[model samples]
Target: MRVEIDGISKSYVDSAGAPLHVVGGLTASIEQGEFVCIIGPSGCGKSTLLGMLGGLLPPDAGTIRFSGDRTATGEMTSIVWQDYALIPWRSIIDNVAFGLEVRGVGKQERKAIAQGYLETMGIGAFANAQPKQLSGGMRQRAGIARALASDPEVLLMDEPFAAVDAQTRTLLQEELLTVWENHRKTVIFITHGIEEALLLADRVLVLSGRPTKVVEDLKVPFARPRTADIAQTPEFGELKQHLWERLRDATRAAEWAEVEGANS
Candidate 1:
């Protein structure tokens, strides 16, 4: 599915009742089946944008539209949160089947569908385990399996691998790519790691500080079926440096803006 975000803005009031603008007329278009990664300085409202895209939050202004075939009868979009929002009381397989259940899928059918995704994520063996019994990475795998089982047209991920160990994060990235290759879901991933963005995305959208907007949209040049070894390449290093410079500048500008606002 192709997503068009135009002039979308959102704001909230601070404790002092002062208005805090988080997204300011942010506009960007994501093409069908495109893996787009969003990155920005802290407080840039990346998650807020994702929330609006998923219909969890409303934009104060502007529109978000979807143009494409509705292949799935279930929800149009599913989100994989950073914390792996799973039910502690449910078994891993049950957790994965939750979305399907919510959609009114029959018990045996939902379990079958959920099992397929669990096997795809390489965690089928943990089907009966509770969320608390699994490691951070394992829980995240279950979370992703649950999202995929719903067969959403678009997947919104908010730093889904951020809580896992470095080695586990690398493994999960590769696993996600493999699944994405087969399923071709339109993905909008938000992350603070520039390298993670480069590694996973077909294009990276870099946002400005608070009241954020897309400041830069960069295409990743590496061929698909990517691995962590690509990070050793010179092109990857150069692109990483470029993103670092841009992110540093945005962070500094935000800091200055905060100082000015405090004084004013």
Candidate 2:
């Protein structure tokens, strides 16, 4: 395993001095190269949990470990953002190589590394293009390339396709699977889209309400290389319905919490 969250919890004091818990004793294990998706209601602190996994935020209790890779803290993660987080002034190749450059990788070597990633993403044609020059999907590919270029043991993605159009989103989904198939990099992807989660994940983690914790961890038994056609299958429908039912409970719980908090 590359990632483990052992009874992890996060809590903070509200402005009024009341205790606020974001995550509650959540636990999960992710094998190296496995793609896992965390899904839950809007305010359930799924993002907060992801932040913990990346070592960007410290949990108030329990632990998140990147086994054998780092001591005391997880050091396996590299994050990809929804907005594609590329510099506007940087060329496509430059943006992809940014991490390597930061690590003091020489120009010739970093450019070669960037070129390989761009070709893999099928965006080599746009190497000289700036961020503004590419389409939304292309820019996202650049971001993925940037993440992959770092060669991290784990990849964390936050709604990476949400910024693109539906068509582009579909294409990215296909491209993402291709990347995963080829590289087998351990990926912890977070998404609000249930279908996207089901399509990409080996396992789907459903979280409940505020003080979010794992409500369900459903395995996806479907075969890989998922296309839009796969979405039309009966098995896909069954999986989708199952996920919806799980999330429905979480949504209701979140709403009730809001109502109760207001009443109090």
Candidate 3:
């Protein structure tokens, strides 16, 4: 396994200063270069889990471990946030090279590396263009370019395409598949969209509501080089229905538990 998550738990202070548990004893593992997607009901700490996985936040208990050629130095993980987080003032190429520059690489070297990624992302022509000049999909391509330029061992994405239109989201999903095919980086993607999860992941982990855990772990049976048309197949429909039922039951259980606690 490239990543092993063992009994990971996290809590936060609520608005009333009460301790709110978000995740509890969540355990799973991602194989080296495997792509996994996580889906859960709203407010189920999906982003919080991604944060912990990316080492952006520390868990209150448990651990996330990386093995198999992962290094102590340099960035082993990079994130693509939903908002695209581009530097509006910088050109697209500069934005992609931002990480390398921060590591003290020479401007020429960073630009060359960033340009290469931009080309791979099919955004090389926009290298000199400002972020504001690009469309939502184009800007997101730049964000992906930025993350890949770091040459991460694992890529963590928190709903990176949520802000785009449906058509554009589909296009970006295809783009992501193309990129992943080339680099084969271990990816842990978080999304609310079930179909998107099914389409992209080698496996899908469904999470429970607050105080979340893995409610179900489903291996995607579809072969690689998948297309949107797969969603229409009977097998895809079957899996989707099963996942929906599991998620519905998990959500209902959480709501019922909350209600019972309130009454008690």
Candidate 4:
């Protein structure tokens, strides 16, 4: 579903009881079935924005409009968080079916449906295994499977692959792309990796430091079924360099501001 974020803003009170702005008048449009990645310096409220989009948190100001009334917070959107958030005590299959269970789906039906997603994620064999028994990458696959089981109109992923190792991260990226191609789900992915953004996103939205707003909204022109070799292309390298510089500069500026605040 298409999502339009209009004049959205948020802030929180710091330890010193001063209001600290996180996002400011951030507006963007994500078309139906579009894969959009938001990149910015650390602590710039990227995750916070994702939370608002998912309807887990409300914006302090402004509105999030979804075409056809599919607000991000409803069943139209599901989020796969960085921590996986799977139940350690439950079997993988049960965890994957948890949402269905909450929706009052029959046991047989939920398990059957959950298994379908597990097989899709290539984790069917681990269906009965406890989460702790699986490797980090495998656990993340299970997490994605669980999200897919919910069959959301849009997937809001907050650093979903950030916990995995490099090789595993690349593999997950490829697998995710394959799934996206097949299902064509609207995706809003938040990340710190410039190359990761370029490799997976149809468009990349760059944000500045705290009180963050979009600094750049770049469309990636690379052909789909993207592979590792795509990263080696000169055009890919140039875009990556440009995004890196933007993020680096924002980070440095935030650091200087923090130092000055401390001295004052």
Candidate 5:
């Protein structure tokens, strides 16, 4: 599905009872089956944007429109949070099948579907284990399996691998790419890592400081089936440097603004 976000804005009242705007007139277009990564300085409202996209939070202004067939009868979008967000009390398989069960799929059918996704994620053997029994990386794989089993048209991921170890993160990234290649779901991923964005995204959207907006929309030139070897290439280094510079400038500006606001 293609997603069109136009002039979307969101705000909350701060402790001082003043309106704290996080996103202001943000507009962007995500094409069908496109893997788009969003990156920006800290507190730039990336998660807030993802929340709105996932229908967990509503925009204060403007519209977010999806065009094309709803992929499944379940939900239009599913989110994989940074913390995994799996149920500790449920078995891994049960957690994976939770969404399907909610949609009233028969028990056997949902279990089969959940098992398939767990096997795809390389954690099928852990299907009967409780979530707390697994490692962080394994838990995240289960979380992803749960999201995929729902068969959403659009997937919103908020730094899903951020909590994993470096080695585990790399493995998960490769696995996620393989899954994306096979499923071709529209993905909007938010991350603070520029290299992660370049490695996974067809395009990267850079946002400005608070009351954020897309400041730069860069098309990644790398080819699909991306591997760690790509990072060793001079072109990859150049792109990384460029993204770092952009992020650094944005961060500096955000810090300055915070100082100014405090002084005011």
Candidate 6:
């Protein structure tokens, strides 16, 4: 679960033939079983960085290497996307088992494994239901269960709770902590929610505006089993305010990143 991200950067060529930089010289490391969150302003390349770490996208100028025995190539990763991305035709249980099916696991075996995560994610009741039948929060939980059922060593989540309502979002955040506590997988979650990162992560990586890089990598001193209760406490407010101040500067800079030459 140990990951070394060394000087990673990424750029996309725009329609007008300019290079649009996303990540820029971002370097960091994640110890085994650590829950790491990357917090940033919107469009700050947090998900781009996560994509590189997951081996889905190549960095333009750096390396992502896993130096741990727990996972070869970093323990095989599962990504919980912002969009639920469930198969409309598949039942909930079948959808959760989809990743395992890709790896050639037998149906019965995969179903057994999927069943465990479905219960863990609190969506086992929806096992026979279709994605269309579920609420937004329930669908997200199913998406998470689908990822966890594979039992990967690393879980990369890209704003998994953002699409739901605020109350449902809060509930989902708590559910995510429970799952993370039990699994202890090395997790790198991408979110723009300052408080969400503070509540859910062991450490937070704050990224700068586009051509994004690490602005701050601060460890959270909060105790385990973090809940909404902690959110109203003095400690929580202090951390929240601190992160907000840091992000306020980044937000101003985020506007400049939209210019064509950052693409150029």
Between candidates 4 and 5, the one scoring higher on lDDT is: 5
Tell me how far the alpha carbon of residue 35 in candidate 6 is from the true structure, in angstroms, after superposition: 0.9
Candidate 1, backbone clash total: 0
| Model 5 Cα lDDT, one tens digit per residue, 1-264 | 999898999999999999899999999999999999999999989999998888878899988888833322239899999999998899999999999988999999999999999999999999999999999999999999999999999999999999999999999999999999999999999999988999999999999999899888999999888987799999999999998899889889988988999899
Put the candidates in lDDT order, highest first: 1, 5, 4, 3, 2, 6
Per-residue lDDT tens digits of candidate 2, residues 178-201?
Answer: 999999998999999989998899
Error of 2 at 9 (Å): 1.3
- Report the alpha-carbon TM-score of model 2 versus the true structure: 0.94
Model 1 C-alpha lDDT per residue in residues 63-118, reported as the tens digit of each score: 88888332222399999999999998999999999998988999999999999999
Q: Estimate each model's TM-score.
A: 0.97, 0.94, 0.95, 0.96, 0.97, 0.94
Provide the overall lDDT of each model, using Cα atoms, as 2-decimal numbers: 0.93, 0.88, 0.91, 0.92, 0.93, 0.87
State the TM-score for model 1: 0.97
Error of 6 at 191 (Å): 1.1
Per-residue C-alpha lDDT of model 4 across residues 82-134, encoded as one tens digit per residue? 98899999999999999999999999999999999999999999999999999
Model 4 compared with the native: what TM-score? 0.96
Q: State residue 225's C-alpha deviation in candidate 5, in Å.
A: 1.4
The true-versus-predicted C-alpha distance at residue 42 of model 1, in Å, is 0.6
Clashing pairs in model 2, backbone N/Cα/C closer than 3 A: none
- Greater TM-score among 3 and 5 belongs to 5
What is the C-alpha lDDT profile of model 6 across 119-141, one tens digit per residue?
A: 99887877999999999999999
Residue pairs that clash (backbone atoms under 3 angstroms), model 6: 19-263, 20-263, 71-75, 261-264
Write the number of the candidate with greater lDDT, choosing between 1 and 3: 1
